[model samples]
Every structure is written in structure tokens, then in C-alpha cells.
Target: ALIAAFEARIRAQPVHVAAEVQLAATAAALPPLSAPVDEEAEAPAEEAIAPRAPQEQVRVRADLLDNLVNHAGEVAIYRARLEQQLGAFRAAMAELDRTNARLRDQLRRLDLETEAQIVARYQREQDSADPTFDPLELDRFSTLQQLSRALNESAADLTGLQGVLDDLARQYDVLLQQQSRVSSDLQDGLMSARMVPFDSVVPRLRRVVRQAGHDTGKQVQLRLDGTHGELDRNVLDRMVAPIEHMLRNSVAHGLETPAERVAAGKSEEGTITIALRHEGSEIVLQVSDDGRGLDRDAIRRRAEQRGLLKPGAVLTDTELDSLIFEAGFSTSEQVSQLAGRGVGMDVVRNEVRQLGGTVEIHSVVGRGVTFTLRLPQTLAVTQAVFVQIGETTYAVPVASVSGIGRISRERFESGTGGYRYAGEEYALHDLGLLVGQGPAKAEGQAQVPLLLVRAGDLRAAVAIDQVVGNREIVVKPVGMQIASVPGIYGATITGDGRVVVILDVAPLVRRHLAQRPAAEAEAQQQRHVPLVMVVDDSLTMRKVTGRVLERHNFEVVTARDGIEALEKLEERVPDLMLLDIEMPRMDGYELATAMRADARFRGVPIVMITSRTGEKHRQRAFEIGVQRYLGKPYQELDLMRNVYDLLGIARARD
Candidate 1:
């Protein structure tokens, strides 16, 4: 009956009644319900779930991280300085202890002597039967007794102080060790935070290769290995442009067109590979291309046209390969969007150098070319060798040093123009002179310590006044004014609180090679002369000595004192030296000792002639290896005999 009523209502108002009519019909077709359910049967759900654990990592602003790194590096520098200071303090304590022991021994001797004198006086008074001679008077305070007692008390106090100082030194040492460990950990953590994977720049590198191949109308494939390798974020960011430039160069210059490759029996597609890996403390990156290699003839012609090489200049293959990095040097015939403006490789070299790194080229003319870049694992801190060149200290990156040795000043000036090590000849350079520090004071040492360094294909032996030992240094940037200076890469603070310049070896080697030809020519011309050096403060003495040597058919060099003589010795070594004992700056004895210690001048006989003709002076001169000692107003014949004997030459006809 309800379904019929709903149907009649739907016909009256079809749109509104349709849903009600359908509900009524469905209800009429269903079976009857059994029972109603209870509301209590169902349980309520929990209002909230357990809270999630806090995030373990959070992003930090780069500048904030960089500032933290700087602070940590400062802490490290302070720790190193504190360690040195502690060592110095320990040495002072040891000296103080020795001084105290000596003082106590002297006081004991004084006390004993005073007691013996008092006993002797008492015995003399008693033996003479003097009534005023009292036995108690012997024990009474006298000036000598009082002085001895005071000395004994002071010595005892010094011994107590020494014990306290020793304890304090030990405590300080413990503290310093703890600080060192903490500083090392903090630096490592900060550097690790700054590291980023190599794949961070892989996308951009691929884009560079793709775009370059498209523009050059060549088929090129980019392959990457060791993408998981890591570098400091700052280093990776700076390397992007340089790596991109190399990729473009390989595509434009290294690869051949598809048709050309096919004709040459190579695959139609060319491959360029970028490999990254860690080598010891450095990160090595290599960009290589398997295609038509560098055209040696084309590069040679360009070098000639650019005047970098003389026409028909004879050069080894390595030497010729290095010329491509010269600024504004290119072998491309026509200027194009990709190349021929002559700008890429030099910029690449400069960028790599700025990062405290080195770049090298390995190419086979028909095979291919590979560019290798070796960079510090991190820019924040690096291992460097500190060397004292003059009053100042400088740091050389350990990565650049191949070996260290001591070369006699004689061997350096032997007109060989270089030092040989491991069967290879390396050009020798004076670090003090190269940096405009003038000649370093020899400080009585005979041999100069030198570092054998390699920069790319170039090698040189850099002579320094002393090796200050190797250290891990925090690198700091110099201001814009100093940054433009050649051969200076950056600055570091030593443990002694001195700011040392970190040398860029590549630029130094380049500068040396650039000036080598002229230096060699000059050395050749002066090598034939038997040079005699006269060192005296008196103008008349120098003039008379020079005149005698000149008359004897020998070349003469004169210096006002030992300092001047050392400076002149840089030019050439003399066959024999005439030294005066009383000259200023550096005395004759000091000079002789220094010369005898040095292997270069040890064979050169020295004659000391001074106004002070005492036996003591003569003995000291002979002890210092001076061959002859003469008093003032020496006989001319005597001087000539000694000179001729030392030179191993026969006397000339009178």
C-alpha cells in the first residue's frame, strides 16, 4: 500500500518524488530485520598516536658553518702555539734546576773553607796562650759565616722552587695534550661537515659536454667514474667552471667529427671521461678524451707565431706540451664560439693554483690528451713544510715536495745551473733571492737545506736557509692586494705566532724557467775565471789585496765584511779567501767557521791577517781551519806564497 502511495506522489511531482519512490520500492523488496544493535558494543578509537622522534639532522647556513670552521681553526693555531710555549717552559725549568745545583755546590765549598779558617785562627790563639781567645768565639757570627749561611738558605729555597716548577710543568703538559686532541677532533668534524660528493657537479658537467657537442656538430659521449668521491663544498663549487671549460675544449679541439672518426677507423661516437679519486691527502681529477689527440705541429706553429718559442727551437715533447697553458695561447686557426680567443687553459691553471693544487697534461699525439688536477683534500688545513729563508718563515705545501737534501754552496755554484737527484737534474733556486729577501745570513752553517719540488712537468731544487720542520697549517686568505702577487698562494699562521706566506710552487718554477736562459749564459761566461775574494773592513786593505790578486792574473772580488762576502759568493765561489778577524757584521772567525762547515767552501783555503796578532788569536784562527795567520803589515812575498800554495799554482816569473 505504501509503495503505491509513493508511486502516485512521484507521478504528481516526478523530480522530487523519484528518490523517495525508489527507497519505498527497495524497502518493500527486502526481508524483515531480526533485531537492533547496542551502542555499547563498539569501543571508541584512541585520540592521538605516539609522537615521532625528533629529527637527527638539521640544515645549517653555509656562512654560519664557515664562521664556525674559522673559529675552530683559530683554536687549532692557539693549541699549537701553546704546545711550543710549554716546551720552552720545560727547557727553562731544566736550566733553572741546573743553576740551583751549581749554586748549592759553590755554597758548600764556601762554608767548608770558612770553617777551616776559623779553626786555624782559634788554634793559633790557643797555642799562643791568649786569655781573650774564647772557645765560644769560634762559633760566634762573623761576616764570612753569616754570608755563607745566607747562601746556603737561598740555595735550599731554589731547590724547593725547582720541585714546584717541575710539578707545574707536568700538569701543563697534560693539559696541552688534551687540548691538542680536542682541537684535532673539532677540525676534523667541521671539515667533514663541509664535504660534498663529486656527483654534485656531474649534471652541470654533462650539460657542458652536451651543449658543446651540439654546437660543434660532433657526436660526443661523457663518461664519469668515481662519482661517489667527495670534496670540500667550497672546492667543488670553485671547480665547476674550470671543469666545464675543459670539457668544452675536449669537445672542440680533442674530438673529431663523426664522419672524420669513421674515416679514421675509430667509432663514430667519441668518448670523454672524467675520473675522480683520492690519492693520499689529495683529490685527483682527470679529464680525458679518446679522439684525435693534440697536434704537436700545430701547437708548435702557434707557439712560434706567439713568440713563446723561437723558430725551429729545439724542445722536448713535455716542454712543448706545457706551452699550451701560456696566457692567450691557442692553436685554433679561426675564432669561434668555442675556442680560438685564446683564454681557456690559462684560466684553468690559475684557478687550480688558487686552490692550492696542481694541473698536469699527459698527451700522445695520435692517442689523446689527459688533464690531471691534484687538489688538497680540504682548503681549511693542509700539510706544509715551514722553511726559514731569512728573518721570515715561509710554508711550502708538502704535496709539491719530492725530497729534501743539503747541497754545498760550492756545488750550487759549480756552473751546473741545477742540482741532480735520483738521476734527474733539477734547476736550483735560492728561495731568499727569489722572494727579494736579499741573501740570507748563513749563520755559520756550511750547507744550505734545499727542497726538491715538482710542479706539473717542471722540477727544481729550492734552497732555503734552514728547514723549520713540517706542520699541518690552517690556510688563510690574503687581502686583494697580496693575492695578485705571483708565487704567493695564501697565508698561514705558524705556531710561533708569525704569519707565513704559503708559496705556490708552479708559479715559482715558471718564473725560474722564464729567467733561466739568461742566468745560464752569465754563469757560463764567469766559470773560466779563478776568482779570489778579499774580505776586509778597511778600504785600503781591500784595494791592496785586490791589486795584488789582479797583478797575479787572477780575478778579484772584494767585500767589506763577512755579510758582503756571502752575498757576493752567490755569484761565484773564489779559489781562496783572505779574511780579517776584526771586520764588522760578521767577523773573520765566524766567516771561516761557516765556510769550513759548508762543503762548497771547505776546500778553499782561508788566510786570516789582522792587526790583533796575539797567540790566542792565531790559535783560534788555526782551530777554525784558517790555513795561515799573519799579523798586521804582512810581507807581500809571504802573502803571495800562501795564496799561490792554496791555489795549487806555481809562482810566476819575477
Candidate 2:
């Protein structure tokens, strides 16, 4: 109406003023409404203009959503087929075992009954001389003879029936086992088919993290690794919204503004690292930030004031951390609806957990915070370690291995004081005390084996009595139970018919050390010795020795020629030496003789590292006696272990 009124007035006005307004309006037209607009948006229009049309809802065909629903249901088909085949096959085998046992018992009973009848007849025949005195004796002997014949025939008939039943039982057992195997394989193939790469869900979201920071005037850096890991296709597609919410929370709430971050000695562009890895039965995803961690004490105060927590409540970090997931936990009213309504994370956690996964929280007071998520692989044969817990058997995967060792009570120490090993120190946690199930009765002192595992770049040594070899077992998920266990990924049955609980190293290791003292969090280098430098002219010799030393945890450094060898020797001195024969710049004998003559390297151990198809090298090496002698490509473990033992680093840690 205003534009029409102005046009009527302009026609009556001077021509020059009307021409300028007309030209300006033609250039400006309708305004764009993407970001915030300045004076340009509300300025007087130079020409007649129209507003933007409203966006359409884009109606999708019913069949598209139907197809999505159908695809989701397809996953259950494989699961149903697997469950049915396994269940039926197991039932059939059980029936076979029972039938075989029943048949065998029946045959044994028939045999005993036949034997008793025979014995009675024999006794009657032996006493027949006295029976001749009476006519009744002859009649009794005839009756006994008839009973013995009947018993023998009955026993033979039962034996024939038992043989037939046994054959049928064996066939059923074999058929059931085959069906179980085929079903497991089909289920695995189906699962893998449903997996979609994780990046697909978050590709556009990566840019959102940056844009969120820009809008809020906060600087942030996004780091993503292992984006190649996969999740269910539909689940992956729906994941963008939840993850985007988290990213918003991170920029607006978790990360400090640029000025604040800079004052705290952090980079202006705060770092957020996202990682994904497959652990046993599941895919472990982590999103962490080098920003302000969770404020536990603050959270506690709020909870108490709001009556969410009772006064003087004693709660663990794990329990306190869960308060963030409570419904309506959001405290920031002026904030955008992106996150922190306490509702967003709850939805995310529920959606993931419903898919057979769990979420956890870990933070450092000064450094940063991490959110850990565990999602089952769903489509592949997961590696698992099978062990017996109570009456049931379970498996745990080998990827969780820290290292294996043995510790007796004499070697065990309390968790407080630091223990020394290999001229270094380490804090210890007695495995028996931690598990609460050491042994009913241990013989030959209280000794136990240990396994050292890594969690988020941190290491912990755990103790166990036995080490089962690695296996690829089909993961069977248990509902509700997975939520309660911090480290469990899934369960699997072993080839030996034992059930094993697969342990996820990330959570298991973290939980193991979660309650312990801060000293236990020290670097693993204290338990590990320094790297050793080995120099040899032969390529085979260098690789062979390096592997041996490395297996024992002595970081091995090697060189192939004398020029490179000498340079390394000059830069660093090794714990021990293996001088080789027939080299370019120097030979085995010459290097050894030179080492003994040099004052700086005189104390170093120099073993005769050679392969001379003869005893001459040995005789010459003995003359020096600087160290022991070893042949070329010698049994790797022996030589490296000997070096470890000599360096005082071979002893097991408690």
C-alpha cells in the first residue's frame, strides 16, 4: 500500500527525485535474511520490492519412510534366524544326550536282571542231588530253567534297542552343532551389512563446531580420528542432531572464551579430540576437550540446594557425574535450545544405550573433560577372552592386555608407598585385594599372575591366574546387564564350551584405577627401562635383535652399517652389546677389542654377536669375556631376555 501511495505521489513530484528513487529501489530489491543484518536491512526502499516466500515442508512419499522402517526391521530378521537355529540345535543336542543316557541305563538294567536269573538256575542245579528225595524238587528245577531262558532273551532284546538309540543320538548331536555354526556365521554377515561409516553422520557437523564457536565469539579446534569406524546405517543417519547438540554445548558451555582460555595458558583455539576404535565386542568412541572440566563440587551444591541430594551424602565421582544426565538439569535459561536442557544428553544417552551401548564421563580439574561412549560392533565376530566367573564361563578380549606377570604375597605391597624396579619406581595395586575373589586355598605362598592394560594412553597392571589364548567369538549381547558393568563389551562361548565375558579395555582399565590414589596414576616409564641402541652391519641381524629386546619392553634402536652404528654409539650407549663378524668399516673381533681399549665404553657389555659355522669365534670371544656369546639369528627371546636380566630389568612387577 505504501509503495502504491508513493508511486502516485512521485508522479505528481519533480522528475529528477522520482528517477533517483526508482533507480535505487531497482538495485536494493528484497533483503537476504541469513546472518544478522545491519542498517542495510531496514533502510528505505529505493524501488518496489517483495518479501521472500516461506519454506515448504517437503512432503515425503509414504513409501520412503516405510522403506526406512522396513530396513530397520531387516536387522531383526538375522537376529531371529540366529536365535532360532541356535536354540533349536541346542535343544536337539540336549535331547540326544538324554536319550543316549536313558538307553545306556536301560541296557545295564537288563544285563543285571539276566545275570541274576542265570545265577539262580546254577545254584538250583548244584543242589539237585538233595532235591531227588522229593517229587516237588523236580518241578522247582524245571521252573528255574524256564526263568533263566526268559531272562537271557529279554536282555538280548534290550541290547539291540540300545544300540539303535545310540546311533540316532550321535547323528542328532552332530547335526545340531553344524546348525549352530551356520547360524552364527549368517548373523555375523548380516550385521556387517548394516554398518555405516561414522563420518557420514558428522561430515557437515564438523563445520558446525567451528561455526558455533564463531557465532559465540569463542575459539575452538576440532580433531577427529578413526572416523572410518562404522555404526548401524539408520542410527548413523539420526546421529547428527544429538552430536551437533553436544558440539554446541562444548563451544558454548564446555570451552572457555578466547580471552579466558588464553589466560589459563591454553591455546586460543581450544582443542576437541574425537576418536573411535573397535574394542572386543563394541566400537568405543571418545569426544574430549582441553577446556574447563565438570565442576563436581558446584554440581553437588546445586543438587543439594535443589533437594536433588540429601545433606552429607557420600557419593562417588561416577555417581556425581551422572547428575548431568538427569532430566531438566539445565540451569542456563538465556542459552539457546541446542543443549543443556538436561534433556538433550539424556535423549542421546537413551538412544545410544537402547542400541546396546553406554555413555561415561571423565574429567581433570585443570586440564579437560572426556565423554566416553561404547557401542557394540553388532555385525562382526568379536574377539573375546572366555573365563569362568562363579558357575558360568565368560570371555575377555586380548586387546585389553596391559602385560602378564606373577606376584606372590611376599612381593605384594600396600597401595600407598611407591615400589622400586630396574632403578625406577611404580605404584602398585594388589590384585587379590581388588577382586575380592583371590583363591579358596592357595598353595606354595600367595602368588598370582598379572596383566597390564592401557586406557586412554594410561596403563595399569592387573593380576590374573591364567592367560587364555586369543579367539574370534560371535558376540551375544545381554540386555540391562551391559549397563551395570563398566568394562564389559559382550559375552561369547569358547570352543571348549565355556562362556567368556569380553572386557572393554577402556572402561575396565579406567574403572580399575578410578578409586585408587593419585600416585597410581604415575607414568608407566617408571616400570619400563630406557631404550637400548644396537648396531650391526647385517640387515637380518639388526631386525632380529631389535624384535627380541622390544618384546621384553626394552625399547630397541638399531643401525645397519658401521658408519651409522658408530654415530648411534656416539649419541647413546646401550645396556649391552652384540658385536657381529665380517663388517665393512669394522669386524666383530675389531669392534670388541676397540671397545675394551676405549675408556668411555670399557664398562659396556659386549657379547659375541656372530654366526661362524665354527667354534673359532667362541674361543676368541671368551678371551675378551666382556660379555656372553650368541650366534646369528639366535633364539630371539633368549638373547634379549638375557640382556634384560643382565640390565636388572627382567623381574616381574607386583
Candidate 3:
């Protein structure tokens, strides 16, 4: 009826005739409202309406997942602490058992002695000719017998208690093992949840390469391998920018124009390959291009023009290549859309460093250039080696440590400030000094502990006071204020609840290489001077003694106390030590004793001068191997004579 009414209205107004005719055709094509339904269709509809399966996956907020991972890490840390406590308890139990055995043996000996005394008393009574004397009296109870019986019963009770404790300890150990397994699984599951395949970023990278190629008017093909490899989502997110920069850099600077490529007997299309894989605990990413390689002469000339290098400064190819990462350094003749302005490479290096990673560049003259980035697999938790630099503990990522050993004084070249490791000579840096904690002192031994660390192609041996073993630590950012500090990666809380700084090995190695030449030059210039150390709590005394040594042409290093002296001694062993008897932290006699105990300082001559002039004081000083003991208000001539004699040097002409 409605269609008929519309058709009549359209016919009255012919201008709407076409719309009315189309509407009538659409209505005629529709099925009638009274059409019948099939019973079979109803049955199939019921089957299709059955309940759907629940979703197997759910989306979770990123911050919520990170919190769960952090909680899991906390569980792991507490588990470690529990393990340490269990070990200590086990040791204490063993010691208690040993003590019980000793007490039982002593009690047995006492019983035997009591029996012998009774026998002797019985003999004495018989020898006295007493008619009432009886052997049964010898068995009569006494205070000693009662006390012994009571002690025996008490020992038996203790033994039973020990057995119960042993059983309880075993049960605790089993429970601890269960907790450890559960904690490990939880941490693993959370970490896995945060991981993403490398291919997740591949599309974005390809887009970047495509755009860069279009901008540069070059034909470039990007090849990606190991797309299935996975990394923590956070690490991958931060890496995307650097990877993009490197791709753009390859497109603009690494690849050549199509005509130039053809002139060089190469294909018109250039290829850039990016490969990702896991190397131990590190994720290794390589970005390579098949184009004209880095020009060493061009880099050198640019560096010279920027005053970064002297005109005739000698540098190896490797050293020359490193200058490209210097901030605002470039070889381009003029600014352009991409290549100039000198910004990308340095930013790339800093980004990688902040991620606790190292960047290495390898280039051949005519082949190509490859940039390798070795980064931690995850920033959440990592295995680290704990070391004692001075009084503080530090954590070094285990991936950076190649080896650990001890080096004797003879093996360390003081003039060169380096040691040999794995057949390669590497500069030796004191971990304490590197961290601004002063030089690390050897623990009364000539053989100091050394850690061989590597960052890309650079390696160095770091001297530390002691190795505190390894641990699984949760990495925490040190916040923005300290984020730019070199050699410090982050911070972590140890199992013992102490916060320790995580050391970034790449910057340390770079710093050592950068400063080595100057340090070597200084060492050479001061090699002939005899260094004398003056340790005293008195400001006047330190100055007076230092002045005297300096006047005599001796290189003087002063310390407020023995502790400071020990720190300075690690830098350079002094020829002689002038010590004050009374001082804070460590006194002169204690210092002398420690020096005598250390192999490196055992032969160093020590002169003790103090107001304590008692004979016992003098004897104690001598006993500590002090070569001379002079009282306060000592004659300058006498002191000079003793110093000259101990050092085996000629006296100055008067």
C-alpha cells in the first residue's frame, strides 16, 4: 500500500518519477512477509548459537606487567638471602655437634678419674687396718656421683634435642628448595611475558629504510635475518630510534649513487643487512652495508680541522675511526638534508650506552662498514659480579667480564700502568679510583685481584680489593640527575639489602684508552724520583715532614692517617714511610705491622717518630719492622741521616 501511494504521488509530480520507479523495483525484489520457515533451519540455528569458548589471551597494561616482574625479582632476592641464612645455620649445627662430642669425651674422663680416686681411698682405708672398712662403702653415693649422673642425663636430653633439630633443618631445607623453584618459575614467566620478537619492529625499520631511500634518490634493499629472536619490550622500544638513525645514515652516507655504483663495477641497487642474535647473555645486533667504506684519511682531515687532533698526531686506523662519534664531528663539506649537522652517530652511541650496551664499528677501505651493538638481554634482572673496591661493594655485569685472576707486583708494569691478560696487554685501572673512591688497596698481599673486562673491541684489567662473588640483581635506573655519569650504568639492591652501583664496562674501557698516553707520560717523567709517604694526624707535622722530604728532592705524598696512606700506596709504592704513632683510623704501629705483613711493602723502610717515648713503645715499633724510632723534637740531622741510610742514598752536600 505504501509503495502504491508513493508511485501515485510520483506520477502526479513527474520530476520524481525515476526515484519512484527504482523504489518500486527494490520492493518487488523482496520476499513476501508471509513466507514459511523450514524446521531444519531452526535446528541448525540452535547448534550455531551454542556458547563460544572463553578467550585464551587477555590484554594487560604494560605498567602492571612491569610491577609483577619487579615483585618476582624481589622474590628471587629474598630467596637468595634465605639460602645464605640456611647455609650459616647448617655450619652452626655442625659446630654444635662437634662441641657435644668434646663434652662427652671430657665427662667420660671425669668418671674414670672418680673411679681411680675411690680405688685409692679404699686401699688407704685397708692399709690403715680399720676392721669396719668395707668395699661396699666405696660404692656409696656422694655429691660428685649425683652431679655426674645428672650431667649424663642432661647430655642424653641434649642429644635427643639435636636429633629433633636435625630433622627440622632437613624439612626447612626441602621447603626452601621448593620456594626457590617456584620463585624461579615466576620470574621466568614474567620476563617471558615482557619479551617480543625482533620482527615486531621490522616493519617500522623497513618503512624508515624505504623513506630514506626515497629521500636520497637511491635504490636500496634492506635484508633482515633472525626475526624470531626476542628481546625485552622496553629494550626493543628504546633501540628503535638508534636503529632508524643508523639506517638513515647508511642510506645517505654509506650507499653511493646509482651511477657511481655502476662506475665502481657494482650493482645499481645497494643492500643493507640487519641481523639479530643472542650471544651468551647479550643481544648482538649487526647493521652492515655493501657500499664504499669509511674513509680514514677523510676522518683524520676532518678531526684536524676541528682541532680534535694535532696536525701530525699519530693514530691507528681503529683510533682514527673512533673520532667520528665525537659530538659535532663531521666530514661532510656542507649541510644537507641528512648527512651534515654532525649529530646522529654520537646520539646513537649515547643511546646504546644508556641501555648498558657497547657499540663497535668495523670498516674496510673498499668493502663496507658494520656497526655492532652488544646489549643486555633484559634491563630487568641480570647476573652480575660483586667486587669490593674499598669499603663499598659494586656490581659489574657478568657479560662484560671475560676473566678474573691475581697479578703480582712483578707482573704489573708501574711505568706503563698496565698488565698482561690473555696474552694481550691492557691498561690496569684501580676500580676504586675509577669510581672516585680512591685507589683500591691490596689486602696485605702483593698479588692483587684483577678482573679482565671487555667492551666491544676495548679491554682492560681492573684491580679491586676483593671479589665478593656473583648474584642475580634487579636493575634500577639511577634517575635523571646521575644518568649521564660515565661508567655507572644503574643501581641495584643486593640480597643483603645494600644498594650497589652497577658499573658500565664500556665507558670505563674507553676512558682508560683515552687517558693512557698522558698517564704513561707522567709515569715516565716521575720514574726517577723516590716517593716518600708521610702519614700523620697533625696538619703541622704532615706539612713539616713533607717539606723536609721535598727539600731533599724526594717526591712526597702525605696522608692524614694510615688508611689514607694505604689508599695512596695502591697508586704508587713509596720508597720509605715516615709514620706518626698516634693517628685516627689507623695508628703508626698498626700501619707498620700491616706494611710488614704485605709482600709489596714488607721491604719498605719505616721510620716512627712520636711523643710516646716509652721503652715499650720503641720495642713495639722495632718489632713491627720500623727501621728507625725517633721521639718527638728529633734533630733534623739525625732524621735525615736515618732516612738516607734506610733508602741507601747519598747525603746532600752541606
Candidate 4:
């Protein structure tokens, strides 16, 4: 039905139909990725999902944006440095005659990269059948090409004039790294510094509780605590809706009217408490009422009816409480504006989950239903564990990394776009494949490495090549421009000057979900597994050899020849493919050279994952925009490392 709806919308746009088909084509082409998503039994306790704790106090302020003042200051400092560079550039031009050779060398590099971009553009044109874009007629000069040459020339000319200035420049870079490190620290401090009191969200909510007294004809009193604690302002920004929603549920559904309280010889005024507190690394929030508690039987019945629970299934109390979060499972006896139309609580769960937090519920028959929420403390910067999948590397927050394992691929099978893992099914998205290339050195030829990361109650297994070690990184927003990229929560700076993105597993999951239909999502919600393919031609190379990748539960596909490969591809496109060099009739170089020339195979990473062992082959592949490079007889050990270099899997390392 979603597909039918999308097809209808797509048919409305003749121009977009091709892109739609291309997207669907891309989906169809995906091979099942390995499913390593299972709860690790021996995983460290820190990564295990925590039960809901008591509400914590947090101080918040309305002027959180004012703290961004320091980031603006960084722009000013950069501008001042650029001005100095401008003056130096002018003075150096006087000696053009002496260093012309150096300028030429720089220009040569620029020219080469520029030529590569041009050829890449040409490759795109030749690949497309649209006929309107003529590659030869539209020769656009690459801006990067021009900048590269200019920088080379400038650096060379500066070599002779002032050793002191050069020393200062290098020193400046060192100082800049120090300054960046300092700025990152300050950013963390500022995130904590600007936190508003948690009590702020409650006062505004208290009035609503008052209003419910008249509307529902029920006497109710509300109390809250823990407003003085400091919280990351960003977290507070999201706290309002859920808090209010929970309060409304308390008033409308949890509380008994005055008549019932009187009949029970209880006081007419009911009590609801919104309490908070801090426990170690988490801030907890809770909503409680002295009224009827949730009906576990009703929830289980509803869940069973919706296929969320197996009929007559035995479940623990905690598992039973988790059922209310499933979509369309509302315990409310009737529909109301606040909830029970079946959408409110799940949104709250997902929102909290995105922040690397969790939610749970508890109840007593005659007392009340208490909804507990746990949010991270500080929310500014976090220490993360970096790991590799195949050739690509990714950073998993040490806060959430449960454990690492290697699954046998022989036990898995592919169905549609994803694969099955363990007895439970999981959509296998190859880290290297999803991000655009095989990772730098991790061909995944050996046994695949799996890192488990938990978000809320869900445990996900991220496949990678190896672990690149760990770091304490300051979380920085990646800005709005590229915010949609999967697996990145925000940007962070390494101890070095490099900036790496903080991984946001929830959004990565949500983005993956947003790409699929409802039923596909349900299939995923089940403990199903998936398959992933590696299509490179190398038979013995580590990245493509044996069942190394198959170890992680991907249904590996190999083709000895291109014709046979294309047939396999049309029959099913793997989640990723790594091509090789020097084959019969269809050599790797020619295959890439020609495939990039066709529209059908444009975005696939046709890496020359072989021992081509020449600068020309590497350069040529780069010219046509091959995703990444690797030497022949590759080792699975380096798969995730390369993937990180190609994609940002392990960029947060020391």
C-alpha cells in the first residue's frame, strides 16, 4: 500500500519517475547485510538497558542560544588569520621569477585533480541516457582544482621568504589544535552551563492540571521537585510535550472522578506527582497519580491481537510494561484529544530513544500508573568506542556499546533488501556498502567483527572490520547542511584537529525505517535476520575471500565473470559490491571504465579490490570516482579502517 501510494505520487511527476525508479532500483539491488543484532549475554553491564529511574532535578534557562557566542568568536579568529594570509600572499608575489618551478608543481597537482573531476563528470554524462547534457560542451573548471593549485603555489613561494613566519604558521596550527581542544571543552561546559531548571517545564504544566479539575469534574493536585539541577539545554527543549502528555493521561485516564472516590470513602482530591532526581550518569523523570493503574491484561490482549505478542506467550513484568510503546496499542478505554487515538506515547518513546535514553512503566492495581523516563546526564560530550565493519569503520558510544561477536553467515539467509541473523531477523546494512565504498583495508575477508550498541530497549549489531580503539570526543552539531547522513548524531573533534561526528543510532535506525514501508518495518520489529552481499571478483583476497563476510550472516555472492555478474546483479543487487582488476574479456579497469559510463550502474562502488599494484590503475579509478582503494591480497583486519577513511566509521580515534 505504501508502494502503491508512492507509485501514485510518482506517476504524477514525469520528471521524478526516473529518479523514483532509480531509487527503487537501488533498493532492489541491495543484498542482505549481515545481521549481528542480538543481545549479548556476556556484554558489559554498563551497556545493558537500564530500568526507569526516579526523576532528576535540572536547571534550565531561556537564553541557551546566547552560549553559541563562542562559536561566533571562532569565526572571527579564523577571519583575522585569513586576513594575515592575504597580506603574505601579496608580498610573496614579488618573487615569482625565483619560485616559478614550485608553483608549477602545485599547479600540476591541482590540474590532475581537476582533470579527474572533469573525467568524473564526463563519466556521469556518458552513463546517463538523458541526451541533454553534452560533456564536451560543458567544461566546468573545478573550484577544488583551482584552490589546490593556488595553495600549492602559495606554500612554495612562502618557503624562501621567512623561516620565522613559516615556523609561526606551523606553531599556529599547533595552537589551533590546542585552541580547538579548548573550544571543545568549553562547548561541553557551555552545554552544561546553559541548562535551565527542570522545574520550568512543570509550572507551565501545573496550570493544565488545574484546568483538568474543571473539565473532567475530578479533584486533582499536582506537585513537582528537582528544578535546581542543570541539564543540557537541548534536552530540555524536547521535554515539554512528553511531560504534558503524561500529565494529561494521568488526569483523563488514570484518575477516578469525585463520585468514585466518594463511593470508596476516599478523599475527593486526587494526587499526581511529577518527580525528578539524578542517579550516576542519568537524569530520571516520573509521572504518578493516586488513581487506577494500567491494566496489564488489557495491554497484553491488545498486543496479542495486533500480533505484537505471541498468543499465550509468557513474559516478564518489564517486558509486559514495554508493550504500550508498540504503535497502535493504547490502554485508554476511549479516545480523547490527549491520547488513545494511538499515537502519543510511542512518539515520546522514540524521542527519548533518539537522545540515547529509555522509558518504562510500573503500576499497582489501586494506586496508580507511574511512567518513568531516563535521560543522559550532561548530553554535551561522551566517550565512544570506535569499531569497523567490513572495510568501513564507525564510532559507537562507549555508553551504549554492549559487546562484540562474530556470527556464522552459513546460518543466515537473504529475503528482499535485508537479512536474518540469529533466530531473530535484522536488516543487515553493510557499513562499508551503505556509506559508499569498501573500507580502507577491511575487505571483511576474514571472520566479520560485530559490535553491539543499544538504543533504548532495542539492541542493534553494527558490522565492521575492526576496532580502531576509543576516544573521549566533544559532541558538536554537524550543522544543518549534512545532518541527514545516517549513523551521525553530531560532530566532535578528536584530540587532534580533526572533527568526527558523534553517532546517533536512533536516527540512523529511524532513517532506515523512513526508507521502508510499514510492513517491512514490522518484519524488522520481529527478531528476524538479513543477508548482505560482497560482489568483488577476487576469489582469495581477504575482503572477498571465502566466508569471511559470511561469518557475520551475510549471504555472500561471487561471480567469476562480468556477464554472469551482471545477471546475478539484475537478479539481485547486493547491499554492496567490491570489484577487482585484470579479469578475462572484462578487465576490472575496463569494467569500471564502462560501468561508470552506464546509467544503470552509476552509484555502485566498483572498487578495484585487487592487487592492481600501480599508480595509474588507482589514479584512473579515482578519475572515474571509484569509492576507495586497497592493495591486493587484502586482510580482513584492515577492512573497517579503510571503510572509516572512505566513510567516517573510525574517524574519532586517537
C-alpha lDDT of all candidate models, in order: 0.83, 0.61, 0.83, 0.63
Candidate 3 or 4, higher lDDT?
A: 3
> What residue runs in model 3 are displaced by over 4 Å at the alpha carbon?
1-55, 126-139, 390-392, 413-425, 436-447, 466-468, 479-485, 506-654
- Taking the tens digit of each residue's C-alpha lDDT, what string does model 3 give over 1-654? 657877888879998788888888888787776779788988878778995687799799999999999888778777777777878788678757865776687788887877677676677767665567565464665688678878878888888888998998999999999998888888999999999899988999999999999998999999988868999999999999999989988888889999999999999999999999998889999999998989888899999988999999999777888898899987777788678889888998888877878888999865789999989899999889999965589999987888897888556536355767778666677675566555556644668898888775677888888899987788887887887777888898766677899998667656756776665455445324577888887766877888888888887888878898999888778889899988767988888888889998898999998999999999988877888999898888898999999988888689
The candidate scoring highest on TM-score is 1
lDDT, residue 645, model 3 = 94
Model 2 is weakest, by summed lDDT over 10 consecutive residues, at: 436-445
Off by over 4 Å in 2: 1-144, 234-240, 296-301, 310-320, 339-342, 379-654
Clashing residue pairs in candidate 3 are none
Order by TM-score, highest first = 1, 3, 4, 2
Per-residue lDDT value at 103 in model 2 = 51
Off by over 4 Å in 4: 1-185, 219-221, 256-271, 279-282, 289-291, 301-320, 326-329, 337-339, 354-356, 363-367, 376-383, 397-450, 461-463, 469-502, 506-654
Q: Quickly count the clashes in candidate 1.
A: 1
Provide the TM-score for each candidate, comma-separated: 0.70, 0.41, 0.69, 0.45
Which scores greater on lDDT, model 1 or model 2? 1
| Candidate 1 per-residue C-alpha lDDT over 340-406 given as tens digits, one digit per residue, 9 for 90 to 100 | 9999999998888888888889998656899999999998889998888655888999878878988
